[model samples]
Target chain A: MSTKRDKVIVCRCEDVTLHQVDEAIARGHRDLESLKRYTGFGTGFCQGKQCVALCARLLVERGGDPPTKPITPRPPIRPIALADLARLVDDGDGP
Target chain B: MTEELTQPFDAIPDACDVLVVGAGIMGLATAYNLARMGAGRIVIVDRSYLCSGASGRNGGGVRAQFSSETNIELMKRSLELCDDFATEMGINVWLRRDGYLFLARNAKRRAELEASVALQRSHGLPTRMIGPSEILSIVPEIDVSGIEAGSYNPDDAVVFPWPFVWGYARACQRLGVTVHPFVDAELEATGGAMSGALLRSQRVESLGQEKHIRAPLVILATGAWSPEVAAPLGLELPNHPHRHEICSTEPLKPFLGPLVADLESGLYFSQSMRGEIVGGVSNARVPPGVDQRSSLRFLGLYAKALTRTMPILGSVRVLRQWAGCYDLTPDGSPIIGRVDSLEGLILLCGFMGHGFMIAPIIGLLTARYLLKNEERELFHRWSLGRFERGELLPESMILG
Candidate 1:
């Protein structure tokens, strides 16, 4: 059997451990965004792609209400290169 | 004891001496400066939580190696402020000054690096041009075959971004500045002069109760949302949001010492304090907007680019991928100063991607400019009217 210190990472993007999520909840981070900000859970490169659902489940399992709403997702749902966007620059001469 | 000032709209005063529009680093730092300067009745409102914008999502690289005299000078002061930001803000920001190494793949880019190093050295920055062998010596893991030349500055650094934002928020609250998160504020213009903003709760229950807050001075520090915020007031800022994505790999024993950048591919990465390799590469086809979604294309591109530069990272597992908006400007320079079109409105947006690094100094300079009427050279060079005057100052050292 795995010991309690054996870290089970819930958010792979941020390397957030399940223990850390419990600690965040203990510290009163009830909502998804609050938990995210407190524990650096869903703010990684994947931007919570795999961790949001896991966090929601953890919240429910811990007797907390499911997050009132999923954390607000921002743009480019996937990582895009800056050079790719720079190539779309019109340089002001488009008719 | 610092009172909890992050209250809802109903608990806030209807008017203040200054109303800061965004809660990102720029807005928060500027409000902290204003409060420290004893500006009375200051209130800062954000549509999202603290550090939810570009300020929170950046790669946390701070460098003074720039191709322009203006940028180098500004970054020099900014670097000094960042060097002591932890002590100043009363928080450990995990600042690491290992250095930043920028590589060039072609002769044209090498020449650009050389010129930029010269300009940077002229401004007292210790940046210098180096060959591939020197680059290899600094970061032995990188593939030096294709690298023609490089520029490196030992003074450049990186910091954990979340603590920086939290530090500023805490300092602002301690200084008696009110910060309201989840509050939607819109600029209100009356008779071509500046007025106040209409505030409403972003929460579902109090959605309809709009509160009007009056202030003589309104500063727009909304990074990607700057244009949207100014559009209703008839101000057309040329700044647009370009999405940039970054990824982090699983922690490994630290080998990389400095943030490395490919000048051509716009790929930059640095090892974090916790041994995670964090960085991003620029894509050529992303559309302009605030879309911050991560993509598989970025992963493939980053994997290829990173391994090509440093082949050993190919086996590293990428743990997370995320995206943020860069408030791109037409001239590739930031717009900072009072707007001539709006009477009491000051413009402080269009930082491209380096807003986090420059926020500390900008906050100080902007406070001086607004409170003491200090005319700074940065304000003149990066004025909003420069774009209209056909005078553009484009910096060549921008990397993602």
Candidate 2:
């Protein structure tokens, strides 16, 4: 009984489905922050770059919360290796 | 216009028994326990959404490895509560009490840990001081070159900060306690006593959005912003805010068994249940004030510290970085309970960096003290009058 919406993966990083996001919306956990926490859509490796807009659209169109401010974007928009960041400076060579 | 808002304040009359300010864990947890004791008409108001304060922005480290007896005792009870948090709060906080390894860099630090472990053991904590080999056995990937020694306890824990806040907010709601976020409250005092607060919506201010409420008792649970909230009401608090930054890496197979901290550098990191390495470093270079902005210097400093501690993590990918203020006191100890200068108000702040960990026991004890009309000497010991009496409790093991 899997439909197209269920099959359509909204968040590639967390593997959140479009239907899953809609269900979280209907359960009163709307808004981008709560929706992100409830559905696990924005906390993955991609950090919501690909899925936040689609989830926001679903929230507003599906009788959830109105469109307010966008979710807060965290730093390191793209993943940075710890080794690369360590060499960010030669602060020292010891612990 | 404020009535259009979805807050359930209309169900609450203008007058109530207790009003808790700041919907963070301290306030939410205290209000939850009070409501469970059948204290009627409890309402909690927050200037922003839940988890927007220090409660939402902490490393979630819970440990009983303090140099002092009282702190160690309080945290021991909190760890017990954390063990039952998932079942009791109906929210999974992912608490793992695997252990906490405090690595000492120099002999002085080693001596400090040695003394702290001795005190912790005397007080029923199974903490022990270990050499470099045992340290290596614990974290196998750690670079123990500069490490002299360590003190470890198997019962220390870390948790996800968000669910701890959410769990208490949910528990309060199930007890008929209303929590309204995004509501800014301006506290009013009459004749040198806390009268109540004037509430307004932060999202939709102006346009006749003000509402006046009355309460006999109020709990000032605002952490870093306590000074700002208390200033207009004519109370000068000694606590100030120090911004701290923390970051997490992408998920991987969980290898680290416990949280590891370098005592000299103030660097602490623990692997989450989702496998991301969450950690932060104490940098004195961060300019003072209520700044939550992250900096490149912090990233560089933290990376250097992490790579120096564990060279193998150099290849790990960092996912995100965020910051929150630490509510600090002059003597490095938390000030709890009632203040002498402020009538009809109880103090629940100045927890410094470790408030998030010890809130469960404090909340329970606060309700027990208020509900049963009993007096705890611990509250009197931590009163604000001690600062004037020069009885400063200088705890030495405070870190990020």
lDDT score of residue A19 within candidate 2: 83
User: What is the DockQ of the complex in model 1?
Assistant: 0.12
Per-residue C-alpha lDDT of model 2 across residues B1-400, encoded as one tens digit per residue: 1111124334435877899999999998899899999888888988876777888779889999998888999999999999999999877898998899999999899999999999999989999999989988899999989889999998899998888887888788778788876677788888878889988765432323678889878888999989898888888999999999999999989899889998677889999998999999887877777888877767777888989999999999899898999999999888888767768888888997999999998899899888886557888778877899898887778776
Off by more than 4 A, model 2: A1-8, A26-28, A63-67, A92-95, B1-12, B204-208
Q: What iRMS does model 1 reach?
A: 8.4
Q: Candidate 2 DockQ score?
A: 0.47
After superposition, the stretches of candidate 1 with alpha carbons farther than 4 Å from their true spots are: A1-31, A42-66, A72-95, B1-5
- Pairing residues by index, what is the TM-score of model 2? 0.94
How much is A29 displaced in model 2, in angstroms? 3.3
Encode model 1's per-residue lDDT on B1-400: one tens digit a residue: 3234355557768789999999888998899998988889889998877777998889999889988887787788988998888888777889999899999888999999898988888888888888978888899999999789989999899999988887888788888887877788889988878789999887443455688999889999999999999998988989999889887776789899999998677899999988889999887667667888877667667766787788777667676677899999988999988788888898999998999999998999999988897856668879898988888998888886
TM-score per candidate, chains pooled: 0.87, 0.94
Winning candidate number (lDDT)? 2
